[model samples]
Target: MNLNATLFAQLVVFFILAWFTMKFVWPPIMKALDERATKIAEGLAAAERGRQSLDLASKHSAETLREGKEKVAEVIAQAEKRALQIIEDAKLQAKSEADKVVAGAKAEIEQEAARVKESLRERVAELAVAGAEKILRREVDVKAHADMLAAIKQDL
Candidate 1:
């Protein structure tokens, strides 16, 4: 290649323009680009932290829901147990009352039977005395009969 005047002048102009660009435009442009890069890195780190926080929160919420379900089941079981206990107690109380009533009825029946036996015995005795008097055919004195009746009653 021939070293020419035009080439030499073109090289000079090119170097001057490059020097001007590096001094004025390149510094500010590189600073802005670096700032943008830093912002992007910070935004990525923040996004990662936010995702981790969300994951942790979701796990905590799931655990809380499980615990709540367990508590509800426990409460239901306790309620069922309590209800059964109450029912059993009521049944026991009713059985006790029924037994008491039966006992009272038995006692009353025994008393009534005793009274009826006593009345039957007295009636039988009166009938026997009347039959004996009819067979004898003698008129018994009322005062003597009353005294004999009182003596027989005392002996019985």
Candidate 2:
């Protein structure tokens, strides 16, 4: 064989093989690489979306907890105000009851004083009659001297 002819033939065959590989085998391999790249991009996008959703959820949870704390503080403040109101009402009621008891006690003292004054007057009249009988040293007819005795009792 001639070396120049053999080298030329080998160059032709190499070009044909390269063209066939580019047309058939290389296209499928490139298509598979593009599909894999697209799938990886989509997966990365999905992961980023999940991270954003988690951040949003955490923010919402914090907001809800703050609102609950505010509600609890408001409730506690209202309860304190109500407790103060109840205490004031109880004090007022107790004062009113004390005033009523004092008034009743004063009324009872006045009634007892009136009864004592009437009894003292009756005792004074009896003592005057006994002293008169002792001075005369005789039994005085109380019925006959009733008018004079009544006048003496009135003077006393």
Candidate 3:
């Protein structure tokens, strides 16, 4: 065989094979690679979105916890304030009760004093009557001052 002729035939055969492969095989391979790359990009985007969602949820939970703690503190402060008000009200009520008791006691003391004074007046009147009777009985100038003695006794 002639070397130039053989080499030229081989070159022609190589061109045909290359052209067939480029037309038929290379397109599908490139398409498959593009599809795979797109799928990989979509998966990475989904993973990023999931991570952001998780972070958002965690922040929301922390905010809710903070709000709950604030509400609890507010409730405790209100309870303390109410307790102080109750204590003050109780003190006032107790003072009023004590005043009422003192007033009642003073009234009782006054009534007792009035009763004692009335009894003393009655005793003094009885003593004075007895002394006058004794004086009149002891003075016995019989008929001479009988009329005057009678008048004095009647005045007594």
Residue 141 C-alpha lDDT in model 3:
54
Q: Write the per-residue lDDT of candidate 1 for residues 41-145, one digit (tens) a residue.
A: 999999999999999999999999999999999999999999999999999999999999999999999999999988877877677666756765477754568
Give candidate 1's TM-score.
Answer: 0.60
- Off by more than 4 A, model 3: 1-50, 127-156
Clash pairs detected, candidate 1: none
Candidate 1 Cα misplacement greater than 4 A, ranges: 1-29, 112-138, 150-156
Clashing pairs in 2: none
What tens-digit string does per-residue lDDT give for candidate 2 at 49-121? Answer: 9999999999999999999999999999999999999999999999999999988998888888877866776
Residues 1-111 of candidate 3: C-alpha lDDT, one tens digit per residue: 546688888999999999999999999999999999999999999999999999999999999999999999999999999999999999999999999999999999999
As a whole number from 0 to 100, the lDDT of residue 135 in candidate 2 is: 75
Question: Of models 2 and 3, which has the larger lDDT?
Answer: 2
Q: Sorted on lDDT, highest at the top, how do the candidates line up?
A: 2, 1, 3
Candidate 3 worst ten-residue window by lDDT: 147-156
At residue 79, give the lDDT of candidate 2: 98
